[model samples]
Target: MINYEEILNSSVVDIKPSGIRKFFDIAEQMENVISLGVGEPDFKTPWHIRQAGIDALEKSKTRYTSNRGLIELRREISSYYKRKLNLDYSPESEVLVTVGGSEAIDLAIRALINEGDEVIIPEPSFVCYVPIVKMAGGVPVIINTKAENEFRLTAEELKGAITEKTKMLILPFPNNPTGAIMEREDLEKIAEILKGTNIIILSDEIYSELTYGNSHTSIAQIGEMQERTVLISGFSKAYSMTGWRLGYILCPAPLCKQMTKIHQFCIMSSPTVSQYAAIEALKNGDDDIASMRAEYDVRRTYVVNEFRKMGLSVFEPKGAFYVFPCIKSSGMTSDEFCERLLKEKKVATVPGNAFGECGEGFIRVSYCNSLGNLKIALSKIKEFLKENKNG
Candidate 1:
């Protein structure tokens, strides 16, 4: 027999599969299960944006856009950033629209990392970062965020991890799996630590617009740090455009050139209709974002408060839609707690270790479902916990 495993890249075998998917597999088989396991928003893409895409299909503008993406879309993205984030980029050279934030991150990592270089990614973060870093021939060094700090990465922690091999740091905020965000003051401390290092920053702001109270801050917004930062954002979260697969990369002119070459070779461009739809999203999507964010805020508050009343220790989430709650009170490991909750109550959630090590005692609950569904799920969870209590 042919030795297929031997021929496959050994690195692929070494990487751990995402723990988030396992609960989903079990949850999928059962009927009437209430899942707070997924990180996606429960909203549909707004009608106007969807209509623009339909119009494009009718006009038959179905051919591929230029690898650098449409000039009009880039211009619109530039304007959108300026109006909303007060950031500026030259559309002609600095913006390369991506298929999604996933591709944007892949392009950024592949463009910057040489073999054996290190990418420092703060943990209890998105599951994709470490694997993507490894595939690009880089080492993934994880830094654990603490619950007391609301999981924000501290400057001291970031500074301690840098070494000569460190090439980049992915600042993932309004973070996944834990709704952590670093406000301007929080980022300034990190900016100070990175000033002397050669480390480039990948500021993944996919959840920027979803922050609850404070306005989102980009590393690029800080003076001098802009040169070292590539802003990664997309319409997936804020505009309910996950299925649209639209995102972009904004970097300094030199890095933009490097990333553009890889994007040209790999993706060509994001979908043409999606690009048109994104233009509608960027220009007119603010109200849609605000409305959905308001709904999420309502649910976020509800879940965190409900979890606390259940006697679970929950870190206060200022952004994104997840609540990272400690489940150690029941003497069950995060994994054991989640598995039991799903099997017994038909309520699905992801274990904290799914994100990284320090996530051991906790579980992530996304508030991306209907209020009625969340209330029902919480009741089930409460009953399960009370029944399982060791005391």
Candidate 2:
């Protein structure tokens, strides 16, 4: 034996595998399983966007792009942010494209954190933040966002978590499992708390275009907040370009320089074909976005109503394609509920604890599947709940 464990990096070894993947693996082995587990869009990439990638291929645009990505793509991203979020950036210096928002987040954290620095992460949010922070040799300080406050990170909770060593705060809004979004007023309050602090805000706004009722607000849009916020977003959610793996970061030039260095060594560039497709998406995908958002809105309403009718307590999700419904009423832990439901009903939902400890009593149900499939899954869940009433 080579003693692989002895040679492996201790920090990497200590990290647990993603909880979301556990149920997904079990679901995959079962035939005819209706999965509401993965946080991926079921929609195909709009034809125009696909054609753009094909067009790039036909033109022999297959070489590695500049380490910071294609200039035209960066410009388009800059314009897109300005048009959609009222934020501006110099594409040449302030924007850097990465494989996905996941990579952008990883690059930013790695570039910023020093050993033992504290990074504040609010949960039940995305699963990647804490692990990524720790991988950067930083301490992960968690602030549990409450369901009572609609899972938004309040100014008070944020202020209470901040300490002299706080180096960064991972802001995951239009959150993954919870589907909570912070409006402009909410950002203003957070901005007030972070006004004089050195803490960098890593704002993950991948679900910005998917918000219902109110428009999405970026903390970078708040006064003085832009200087400290690194905004990460991509075409994965809005343009259904997940497999294409295109994402970009918008930040101050100095931070962008450091992140680009890490990105340069780790990933020379995002896929050239994907960059071309993303350019097309930013330039002409408005109609596609609107249509998808409208359909998701319909699905969102249906899922929320179905969960409530089953007497499950669900906080109405205003954004993202997920609903975190409380499974506590069934007297089962989230893991138990998801496992039993998968085994008996053949409908797979993710345990909310996959997102954080605060998610223990809930189950994350992604509404990203087709209406027919969602209806089938919901019906099965209803039957499961009825059978396991005292579970």
Candidate 3:
């Protein structure tokens, strides 16, 4: 035998597959599966945004862009933050266009993490933070945010997780899986704790535009925290531009310089057509965002209400399009609950354990599908609950 396992990097090999995709893959193989699994938005890219890409192709703008991305797109990114978030960033030095928010995250981790450095991550959050930290040779110190706290990372939790070796703290607000958001007051508390520390923050705010009643707030917006925070966001969730593969990073010039080095060697630049399209998104896509958010709000309310009526304990989410509902009453582990639900009811939903150990006994349900589909899926789940009450 060739013994490929011996040749492959053990660090990469030993990592477990993403728990979010397990049931999603299973549903893909079967017939008539109603999935609330994947976190993708169901909306199409707006016509004008798509037209911009088409225009780029017609004008033959297919060559590689600057290593930092087209200056025009970068300026738009800067302007968007300035106009929308009241945060100032220089397009030339402090902004980097990335392949996606995921890439920006990876670059930030690789740029800042030294071997044995500890990264404090709040969970029931995204799955990527831990693995990314591990790959960068950093230790992941996890703080499990309680359900009673609406899954927000409190200052007490952040204080307790900090150590001398702590290098970065990832703030995944408008968080995935759980739809928790940290308002301005929440950010202030966290900023207060890090006042004198050397700790940097990796704030992933990809879903910033999707907040329910209240607006989204970045920790960087608080006092001097902007100097220490790397803000990663993009056109994915807000503009429904996931497949376009465009995201950006905003931070201090020093950090951007280091991250750009990694990006230059690993990814020459983000997609040119996508960048052209993104400029248009930043310039004129506010209406699109508003429309999408309104529709998502409707779906969000419906899903949470339905789950509550099922007698399941659900943390009412105020941001993002997901609802994390506790399925402990079903007397099944998260994985078992998801698998049985998929097999018996033909409904596919991700187990909450995929996000972190603390997510066990809950299921993360995306309301990103159509209203009709959601109604059908929720009804099927209700049937599953009645049929298998304690199994």
Candidate 4:
């Protein structure tokens, strides 16, 4: 047999495969499984967004767009940023569109990290950050965000993780799985720590439009930090355009130049029709977002309150669409708890450790499903908890 290991890069081999995938591999074969495990919004792209793509096709605008994306699309993106986040970027030089928020993240790290440099990432935030940092030839130093602090990376935590070789800090709030976010004051504290340091900030604001009570804050909004931060976002979460794979990165001029280099060579351009659709999204997707967020708020209350009524310790998520409920009372590890729940109750959710080591005693439950589905899942969960209760 061919020695595949000999030919592959060991760096890729060393990374652990996503823990979420194992559950998916099993769930795919089972019948009657209700998944609260998924991360994407269940809504289809709003009709107008789809109509824009169809309109583009009829106009024969199917050819490759500029490597940085269509001019009008980038212009709309810049406007959207200002209107939504109070940050400014020049459409001409600061924005580079990519396949998804995932690609924007990879390009941001790759464009900046040098080999042996360390990238500080807040966890349990997202699974992609660690492997992407390593894949970009940088060392990933994961900074644990404590649940006590609502999973916001405190200034002390940022300072504690910084070493002489620290190259970048990934701020992943409205954090995935945990649904944690940082307020302006918290971000300012972190900015103060890095004020004189060389560490770049990669702020993933994909969930910027989904914050419950407070508007999302960007680290780039801090004085003097705009030059050092790369803001990443997309239409996937807010606009329910997940499958469209449209995302953009806003960086300093020099950094955008560097990312476009990789983007040109690796991906020539983002999907052409998607770019056209995204222009419409930036222009008119706010109504869609408002409606979706309003609906999520309702479901969020139901799922979170239902779980609390079951006597499980539940943290009310302030942003994103997930809740991290502690499974410690069941006397089972995250994996053990999720496995038994799936097999016995037929309700599917991801174990918290799938996010990072800090996620150990929790399991992430997505509220993206319909109320009918959620009611069924919660009823099943209550029954399972009654049997498994150690009290």
Write down the lDDT of every candidate, Cα atoms only.
0.91, 0.93, 0.94, 0.92
Tens digits of per-residue lDDT, candidate 3, 281-359, equal 9999999999999999999999999999999999889998899999999999999999999999888899998999999
Point out where model 3 deviates above 4 Å.
none
lDDT of 1 by residue, 1-391 (tens): 9899889899888888899888888899899999899878899999999999999999998899988788999999999889877888999999999999999999999999999999999999999999999988999999999998889999999988998999999999989989999988999999999997789999999999999888888889987898899999998998989999999999998999999999888777779999999988887888899999999999999999999999998878988889999998989998899998999999999999999999999999989999999999999999999899897
After superposition, candidate 2 runs with Cα above 4 Å error: none
lDDT of 4 by residue, 190-268 (tens): 9899998778999999998999998888898889999999999998999999998999999999999999999999999
lDDT of 2 by residue, 272-336 (tens): 99999999999999999999999999999999999999999998999999999998989999999
User: Candidate 3: deviation at residue 346, Å?
Assistant: 1.4
Candidate 1, superposed: residue stretches over 4 Å from native: none
lDDT of 3: 0.94
Per-prediction TM-score: 0.98, 0.99, 0.99, 0.98
Candidate 4 displacement at residue 58 in angstroms: 1.7
Report each candidate's C-alpha RMSD, comma-separated, in the order given.
0.9, 0.9, 1.0, 0.9
Clashing residue pairs for model 1: none
